[model samples]
Target chain A: MVLYLIGLGLADEQDITLKGLRAVQSCSKVYLESYTSILLVDDFKARMEALYGQPVTLAHRETVELEADEILRGAHEGNVAFLVVGDPLSATTHSDLILRARHYQAPGAEAPTPVPVKIIHNASITTALGSSGLAGYNFGQTVSIPFWTDDWRPDSWLARIGENMGLGLHTLCLSDIKVREQSIEDMSRGVLRYQPPRYMLLPQLISQLLAAAREHQVDFLDPERTLAVALCRMGAEESATRRGELVRAGTLAEMLACTEPDEAQRRQDEQDDEAFEEANPTVSEKEMDARREARRVQRAIDFWGEPLHSLV
Target chain B: MVLYLIGLGLADEQDITLKGLRAVQSCSKVYLESYTSILLVDDFKARMEALYGQPVTLAHRETVELEADEILRGAHEGNVAFLVVGDPLSATTHSDLILRARHYQAPGAEAPTPVPVKIIHNASITTALGSSGLAGYNFGQTVSIPFWTDDWRPDSWLARIGENMGLGLHTLCLSDIKVREQSIEDMSRGVLRYQPPRYMLLPQLISQLLAAAREHQVDFLDPERTLAVALCRMGAEESATRRGELVRAGTLAEMLACTEPDEAQRRQDEQDDEAFEEANPTVSEKEMDARREARRVQRAIDFWGEPLHSLV
Candidate 1:
């Protein structure tokens, strides 16, 4: 039985290639690596299930990292396929799986074992970033922007971006994604509580970048003079402005600022436990207005007439 | 009617996605952008034709650059698909086509008009280079090595690699390809004679690199110490190597040196403009022996190999 590692490209399930879909359809077991990146679309699981005509077991971080033996055992029984976003093996975990699958032996056997493994390549954000009309070759090392905690904030990635800038090359920044994480207290309480999934928004990223620039004395970036393109849901139906003026940075900052609790809300925090109504994850009026105003400005710059994309 | 810019991925026709194939099947015109890169498989046109179930026209630089108006004109009639190897818009010409296709109008039009354009992203070398187990973000600006001319030899790309090395990053050096090139004399004579297609081999690349290191005083690339990976035919069925040692530099130089004219051959060249056997492109015995020895060494080093490929 062959072990197939397939890439489902960017966007929805339809992004899977004819070659990849064939592999998936023929597999006895299909798994989707879901913790790294997101399709950012509704009904993603249902849509994928409908297209594959098979139930896909969504593999979270712990499952992917710790349950390889079980996955390989399934492959031992019949052909098993793992679906990854972007290219099949960009993540080291996937590559390690491929390498491990090659040497996997039956549970109680001692003889050497080999199951043929194949990989299907697809468009990754590394390549999809080309849609921004920037030369791929000009990009230096990419960086990630994680949500900052109160005490620890690292600016190491910014240094690399500055180095790339020094050489007149572009940087393809990968936004940080947090899926199935737990708050420190939640983890210690043994309650199995999970934090809400979070994807770093562009505004938060820009704010962190601005802070890094100021702290690191990275002269390349000045809020008023520096130009940067904040991309989200690239190559999808709805894409952000291909090019941008730094003015959007102001709007984005305001929008993010508006997401913060007001003085009244902060004062009320000590009075009661969170209520269902207060816990609703909806934007405030001012934040909504800020977002609308930002998009309103972006609408003027989207010359490509791409499909509508919400800048989340 | 929409103008679709589809990426054919790497390798052969089978690499085309289901989405791309459906788009091409629905198109009235399909043009393969052949000048930028190659599928590298034999009988590529026939293979693509058999797969697409429609005629595919191979587009050269002259046709793509000079007769773009004619292509956009076809988009006016019905859906037209322009097929590109790797991602569609990585090359400026292809991107220009997308932008131009947007503004194209019917033949005797007066005011500005808009034509729909959709880009289908696929795996390009920029992303496929990840097969080497190197981080995509760690890659600095990529550079292409062109066939050298006697009067001009540019080492600008080497400097970029040096800068990347300074930042502890990797460099993806793309080898140059020459398809349907013309000699200077042929151009002046207005003759349509074409030169044979040339794909740069590793030996040639190393020769140039060594020269560049010395001439440009590149301190980073020490022939004895600096290691590099030689990759070829990425994302293909018969990928040469997931990665190969640049340590083959010594063997390649030796093998290339063995191909030089011997004393007898050099002496005979003075007496005749050309000889029947002298015009042969076959390798000399010494060159063959050196090649075998190199292969022997490579056999020990090629851990992730499927097939033998020229280094350049």
Candidate 2:
């Protein structure tokens, strides 16, 4: 019996390695960590179930963070699979799980019984960003930009980027993703309401970047001349790479204007959505809301399609 | 027609994604880029042939750098697969091939016919180093340590590492690899002779780091106290991670002494090699030489059991 932590490489279900697939098939229980990143393909859970010939339980933050002992218990009894988007250890939280498994002990047993753990590595954004044709050797530390709230805004990550820029090294910036998050008000009030998932779009990311540059008065990024590459839906069938300079406010829209869907196209997409709802009436409301949010983002950003967007 | 640059993820044949495998199976001709990195599995070609049901041609540095036109020609007429050990674009040379395919023109034709290039990403050393339990976000720019030679010993890469350390960030140091290399004297004499391939081991890497630190008079690295993690054969079944402090001269031997093979084990390995040679008398001289070199490397590196070794 072993605890197998497998990485589902970026893209869709098909991106899983044969080694990972075999491990999934042989497991008595399989868990998919779903909140960190989402696959580009639709019906991901259904498709994975069909392929693995077993039902997969989606492990949300609460499940993974609070109920890990149950997962280890399953592994202690029989082989269990924990699937993560990208490399299993890419996230620091998952590394904590590895440490937990090492020190796990059966609840009833007097002695400690650590469950054996194994990792099946797969492609992660840290490396898949190489599609930008940038030399990995020259990339400085990776930075992540979180979404700004009313009272909480941090610019330390920007300083990290500046440090890398000082050495003429490229920095990999990971955009923010808000999944199953509760609003501050809702949390404060002790309500059970949840907000719709939000994936950071390029326009918002660029806007924040420009705003940060102005506020921090950093020379690392030239508002009119700094070059950036926006990689969207990387490793997917319709993946796109766009290279652009960070220009003024007007230039931002102008650069993306050519690729923006026109009024007629937007109307057609809305009509198609209506037709889809009529055709598949059984679809859950949550799924419909997510799809509509994705469509709204598509109209806002010009060229990108699908999700799991990143920048370099 | 598409020129598919498929990534064979770290470890063995089964590490390739289902999508990559499908693309390889559909290709008209397949070429394995062999000089940049080598797969750990034995008879990699045979295993891939068995999985893909097709012959795979070995594309050495000469064939890929000089004879790329032929490969692009195959893709121009039909689908072709170019296999890379890690992520295809991880190496700059492969990125050059992508550019060539994009601008490729058909010979003896009136107009240019650029072939479509598609990349199937996979796990690379950049991200697979996550197995060390280090956060990818804290890693600074990657640096490569080249094997020093008489008259030209560059330590600029050391400076890059020092910069990373100054920022309280981790640095990924890629070890040097020499394949199908010809000595300067041999090249000057117009000789076709080549030197045996060499891969940088841990001792040599640490020795170079310490020597450069002393020569440059840098305070970034403390020879007696700087902590370092050595990641070897990452993503493989027997992948290992070792953490230790960078101690003085004699301590290096003391740290590695525990993992070193004993005299009896060395004798057993030599006897096993002799028995293998007797069993497979028809094996090529080049194959035997490569095996012997790999064995020598194993004895030099205490814990690493494969050729592709990296450090963080």
Candidate 3:
């Protein structure tokens, strides 16, 4: 049995490679890995359906974990393609699945596992950072900042950024996202609670970073000296914007102060969040925290300066 | 005069979004940032010309550093666009450029620096990793391992990876790419030493990691217990493959064993390098050493487990 894994790059469904498209066409069944990251738009299923003239099954996190054997059951009978968002093997879960398939295929074989698993590579954020004109080699560390509670907020990202600064290497801070669900009331009742599924923004991130910097007394950052770029709506045509700027006291304060929810925009955003929450009630609190942080960061940046960071 | 900054996702001129495409089309001039990362295929100028139906200026590292005023000179005169791979502002260089533009625009409000800068986002590797089925949040710190040298091999990557592992987070290791350079020997003789440019491969990275693990006694990696994924030929339709298996003693040993080079492939690779070296000969010896170490690692992996990494 042959297994074909395909990556759907950022943006819409069409970001997939021609090779991946063909694999999807030829495969008897297709499964889209849903959960890790998401396309800016949710019409990927419709787009792929139109492009491939076939239906695709959505593979949620749980399905991928429990239905591995089922997913591959028909691979031996025909061809099966697993559709991923970016590069197929970039994540360990996919790798684990591939390993599982190999194990199943070679149950009792003395020779190495013989099933052929093919991967269709797509652009990943790692490679995408190169677009920023940053020396790929000069990047110190990539860190993700999750949503934190007043009591349990973690300061790991600060250490990471500090380390990067120490080495004069840049840091790629991946904003967080919340895909699952948690009740706001329940969260509020606890020491820390998430309101809804959210994508972290730049403002929230800056606030956290500033607080951490103060707590640690790491003068590694001078709001004016430390530069930051905030990106939102990645992968879509209207992929929102990327703003770069110095995170200084005035700028940071302005960003945080501007978080007065835009009545109209906030309404729309909340509606979108509600829809998502309704559809996926089991979204974890951790994911929500990450998304919130991402949104906060984005908001902060937008408020501090226009989408583009001010050059000295 | 707003500057529209857009990220062209991956390969193919059409990889741009409708909005981004329109922004480029409307702009009187477009600058393509070419140094940070490159597309798997498609020449920059050719692709931009075909897509925008206009001449596209190339912005190499030097142009970005020396010609900032020139690049932003006509922003107020007409629409101008800066083309970046992946997403704009992903790198600090672009951010700095944007900041500079903003500064000029902020002064004396004579049409606000003539050009208003706008950033158009696209699918970046950061968000794209979600497609890999790896929890984006699960990833801890990312580090780049440059081509090392016998005289000064850096084991920083080992420390970074170890820290990530200690936190049970995955580490994304970016390999090095020598874009422009001369031969090492020529430089020694006061002649321009031009060596072919190169990109680090999976095998080289693995070897170095193995060496570092062994040397540092990083107990986190069991060779067999350590899980690693290599991506080759990223963003190409036929370029992605993944190799994953238990890192066993036999596998490591097999990887370290020698194998004959495919002369034809080697020659072709060298030819590509020669062309790049001819144009730019000031290659760093440190980079070369890192590349060599990476190559050795690649050889081991290729010989050992049939190259479990992927090329896209």
Report, in order, each candidate's fnat. Answer: 0.60, 0.83, 0.13
Query: Pick by TM-score: which candidate is best?
Result: 2
Clashing pairs in 1: A141-B137, A238-A308, A238-A309, B201-B312, B202-B311, B202-B312
**Per-residue lDDT for B80 in model 2?**
99
Summarize candidate 2's per-residue lDDT along B49-133 as a digit string, tens digits.
Answer: 9999999999999998899999999999999999999888888889878889988999897878999988888988886878777
DockQ of each: 0.56, 0.62, 0.13
Q: Candidate 3, which CAPRI tier?
A: incorrect
Candidate with better lDDT, 1 vs 2: 2
> Which regions of candidate 1 fall more than 4 Å away from where they truly are?
A238-312, B238-312
Candidate 3 has an interface RMSD (Å) of 6.2
**Alpha-carbon lDDT of model 3:** 0.63
Error of 1 at A288 (Å): 17
Q: Candidate 2 residues A1-312, lDDT tens each?
A: 899999999878999999999999999999999888877776889999999999999999999999999999999999999999888888878987888998998989888899988888888887777777788888888888888865888778888888988988887778888889999889999998879988787666666777888899987676456777777767766424522222122233343453466899888978988898999999888888889766756665545543555667
Q: Pick by lDDT: which candidate is best?
A: 2
Per-residue lDDT for B217 in model 3? Answer: 82
User: Can you write out model 1's per-residue Cα lDDT over B1-312, one digit (the tens) per residue?
Assistant: 788889888677877777788889999999999888888566789988998888999889999889988888888778999999988867766778867777776777897566788888888777676666666656777888776777889888888878878888877777677889998999999999999876666556667778888897877877666666656567566435334212123343454443444689656644442352366557476665565545533543343232222231
Restricted to chain B, the TM-score per model reads 0.78, 0.81, 0.71
